[model samples]
Target: MQKKSSIFTATHGVMTTEVGVISGELELRTTCNDAGILTLAITYVGAEEWYTLPGEDYRLHDPRDHEVVHRMLTNVLERT
Candidate 1:
């Protein structure tokens, strides 16, 4: 599995598991398994616990697209 993480500030709240919505400095984690399945999670920066992003898991037709997907999500979620 390949896992990537990026830290960003969410000017608008992001919907997440358990916590409902999270804002401010947060970390986005994208995990890709051998089967090209992707799962996304987020957490407060420096926090040990991670929360799953609602409706964020899916299968990628190309595993190499993981990096691009991760970058896009980071940019979109950053807001400003």
Candidate 2:
């Protein structure tokens, strides 16, 4: 498996005025097989906790996976 991570800041604002902020992190991990099947696990930066939105250790077969993950993370940040 291969892994990469990054820290991200989510900010809430209205009409150019900043209202709130949340620090978020994302980790992308992958494993591939000889048959070309790829599995992706998306988690918080350090915890290695798999999220339900992107699936619990989701497969990389769907193109919408990235967007779904992004939305889930955004929701988490906003609610914090």
lDDT, residue 12, candidate 1 = 85
**Best candidate per TM-score, number?**
1
Q: Between which residue pairs do clashes occur in model 1?
A: none
Give one digit per residue, the lDDT tens place, for model 1 in 1-80. 99999999998889986989889999999999878999999999999999988785599999899999999999999976
lDDT of 2 by residue, 1-80 (tens): 33333344434411111222213454444444434344544455667445422334444565435445544544554443
Give the TM-scores of the predictions, in the order they appear.
0.93, 0.37
**Clash count, predicted structure 1:** 0
Q: Report lDDT (Cα) of residue 50, candidate 2.
A: 55
Q: Candidates' lDDT values, in order?
A: 0.91, 0.41
In angstroms, the error of model 1 at 28 is 0.4
